[model samples]
Target: MESIYDEIEIEDFTFDPVLQIFQYPCPCGDRFAIALDDLKDGEDIAVCPSCSLMVKVIFEPEDLEEYT
Candidate 1:
Protein backbone atom coordinates (compact mmCIF):
# COMPACT_ATOMS: atom_id res chain seq x y z
CA MET A 1 0.00 0.00 0.00
CA GLU A 2 1.06 3.60 -0.54
CA SER A 3 2.00 5.64 2.50
CA ILE A 4 0.63 9.02 3.40
CA TYR A 5 3.19 11.80 3.49
CA ASP A 6 1.75 13.36 6.62
CA GLU A 7 -1.26 13.69 8.90
CA ILE A 8 -2.47 17.30 9.01
CA GLU A 9 -5.24 18.94 10.96
CA ILE A 10 -7.97 20.61 8.92
CA GLU A 11 -7.19 23.78 10.84
CA ASP A 12 -3.80 23.84 9.19
CA PHE A 13 -5.29 24.03 5.72
CA THR A 14 -6.34 27.09 3.80
CA PHE A 15 -9.83 27.10 2.39
CA ASP A 16 -10.54 28.64 -0.98
CA PRO A 17 -14.15 29.69 -1.05
CA VAL A 18 -14.16 29.92 -4.83
CA LEU A 19 -12.73 26.44 -5.23
CA GLN A 20 -14.52 25.04 -2.25
CA ILE A 21 -11.47 23.04 -1.37
CA PHE A 22 -9.08 22.79 1.54
CA GLN A 23 -5.40 22.99 0.65
CA TYR A 24 -1.98 22.57 2.20
CA PRO A 25 1.54 23.01 0.95
CA CYS A 26 3.20 19.94 -0.44
CA PRO A 27 6.95 19.32 -0.53
CA CYS A 28 6.88 19.36 -4.32
CA GLY A 29 5.64 22.96 -4.42
CA ASP A 30 2.11 22.15 -5.52
CA ARG A 31 -0.63 22.27 -2.94
CA PHE A 32 -2.37 19.20 -1.62
CA ALA A 33 -6.10 19.59 -2.09
CA ILE A 34 -9.46 17.99 -1.26
CA ALA A 35 -12.94 19.26 -2.00
CA LEU A 36 -15.36 20.30 0.72
CA ASP A 37 -17.99 17.89 -0.56
CA ASP A 38 -15.52 15.07 -0.25
CA LEU A 39 -14.81 16.07 3.32
CA LYS A 40 -18.48 16.27 4.07
CA ASP A 41 -18.73 12.73 2.78
CA GLY A 42 -16.04 11.55 5.23
CA GLU A 43 -13.12 11.50 2.81
CA ASP A 44 -9.84 12.47 4.39
CA ILE A 45 -7.16 12.25 1.76
CA ALA A 46 -5.64 15.44 0.38
CA VAL A 47 -3.54 14.84 -2.69
CA CYS A 48 -0.89 16.93 -4.41
CA PRO A 49 -1.62 17.41 -8.07
CA SER A 50 2.01 17.55 -9.10
CA CYS A 51 3.22 14.56 -7.15
CA SER A 52 2.38 11.27 -5.53
CA LEU A 53 2.33 12.54 -1.97
CA MET A 54 -0.93 12.67 -0.06
CA VAL A 55 -1.85 13.83 3.41
CA LYS A 56 -4.52 12.45 5.66
CA VAL A 57 -6.68 15.30 6.87
CA ILE A 58 -7.78 15.27 10.46
CA PHE A 59 -11.18 16.76 11.17
CA GLU A 60 -14.51 15.99 12.78
CA PRO A 61 -17.75 16.22 10.86
CA GLU A 62 -18.86 19.10 13.03
CA ASP A 63 -15.74 20.97 12.08
CA LEU A 64 -17.11 21.35 8.54
CA GLU A 65 -19.83 23.73 9.65
CA GLU A 66 -17.46 26.69 9.51
CA TYR A 67 -16.44 25.85 5.98
CA THR A 68 -19.98 25.47 4.82
Candidate 2:
Protein backbone atom coordinates (compact mmCIF):
# COMPACT_ATOMS: atom_id res chain seq x y z
CA MET A 1 0.00 0.00 0.00
CA GLU A 2 1.11 3.55 -0.66
CA SER A 3 2.09 5.85 2.16
CA ILE A 4 -0.66 8.03 3.61
CA TYR A 5 1.36 11.10 2.77
CA ASP A 6 0.55 10.72 -0.90
CA GLU A 7 -1.17 13.60 -2.65
CA ILE A 8 -4.55 13.43 -4.35
CA GLU A 9 -6.56 15.59 -6.71
CA ILE A 10 -9.18 17.97 -5.38
CA GLU A 11 -11.74 16.18 -7.55
CA ASP A 12 -11.26 13.10 -5.39
CA PHE A 13 -12.74 15.03 -2.48
CA THR A 14 -16.29 16.07 -1.73
CA PHE A 15 -17.21 19.39 -0.19
CA ASP A 16 -19.48 19.75 2.83
CA PRO A 17 -20.93 23.22 2.93
CA VAL A 18 -22.24 22.70 6.42
CA LEU A 19 -18.89 21.72 7.85
CA GLN A 20 -17.13 23.96 5.39
CA ILE A 21 -14.54 21.35 4.64
CA PHE A 22 -13.41 18.97 1.94
CA GLN A 23 -13.31 15.24 2.61
CA TYR A 24 -11.79 12.18 0.96
CA PRO A 25 -11.93 8.49 1.67
CA CYS A 26 -9.12 6.97 3.66
CA PRO A 27 -7.74 3.45 3.47
CA CYS A 28 -8.50 3.02 7.16
CA GLY A 29 -12.23 3.41 6.46
CA ASP A 30 -12.15 6.94 7.79
CA ARG A 31 -12.37 10.26 6.03
CA PHE A 32 -9.70 12.89 5.62
CA ALA A 33 -11.00 16.38 6.26
CA ILE A 34 -9.58 19.87 5.68
CA ALA A 35 -11.46 22.92 6.72
CA LEU A 36 -12.37 25.52 4.13
CA ASP A 37 -11.00 28.24 6.37
CA ASP A 38 -7.74 26.38 6.65
CA LEU A 39 -7.58 25.90 2.92
CA LYS A 40 -8.29 29.52 2.30
CA ASP A 41 -5.51 30.32 4.72
CA GLY A 42 -3.16 28.24 2.51
CA GLU A 43 -3.32 24.94 4.31
CA ASP A 44 -3.37 22.00 1.90
CA ILE A 45 -3.15 19.00 4.19
CA ALA A 46 -6.15 16.90 5.13
CA VAL A 47 -5.81 14.52 8.04
CA CYS A 48 -7.67 11.26 8.53
CA PRO A 49 -10.02 11.21 11.47
CA SER A 50 -9.44 7.55 12.36
CA CYS A 51 -5.67 7.37 11.90
CA SER A 52 -2.45 9.27 11.77
CA LEU A 53 -2.36 10.00 8.07
CA MET A 54 -2.61 12.98 5.83
CA VAL A 55 -2.80 13.77 2.11
CA LYS A 56 -1.85 16.94 0.42
CA VAL A 57 -4.89 18.41 -1.28
CA ILE A 58 -4.43 19.50 -4.88
CA PHE A 59 -6.25 22.77 -5.39
CA GLU A 60 -5.90 26.32 -6.56
CA PRO A 61 -6.84 29.58 -4.93
CA GLU A 62 -9.70 30.03 -7.34
CA ASP A 63 -11.15 26.75 -6.18
CA LEU A 64 -12.37 28.47 -3.03
CA GLU A 65 -14.36 31.22 -4.68
CA GLU A 66 -17.63 29.37 -4.32
CA TYR A 67 -17.18 29.18 -0.59
CA THR A 68 -16.51 32.85 -0.13
Please tell me which predicted candidate would have the highest TM-score against the true structure.
Answer: 1
Per-residue lDDT for 1-68 in model 1, tens only?
86899999999999999989999999999999999999999899999999999999999999999988
* Candidate 2: tens digits of C-alpha lDDT, residues 14-38: 9998888899988999999999999
- Residue 10 of model 1 has an lDDT of 96
Q: Which stretches of candidate 2 lie over 4 Å from their true place?
A: 1-4
Superpose all Cα atoms of candidate 2 onto the true structure and report the RMSD in Å to 1 decimal. Answer: 3.1
> Which regions of candidate 1 are displaced past 4 Å?
none
Candidates in order have lDDT scores of 0.96, 0.88
lDDT of 2 at 33: 96
What C-alpha lDDT, on a 0 to 100 scale, does residue 43 get in candidate 2?
89
RMSD of each: 0.6, 3.1
Candidate 1, run of 10 with poorest lDDT: 1-10
- Winner by lDDT: 1
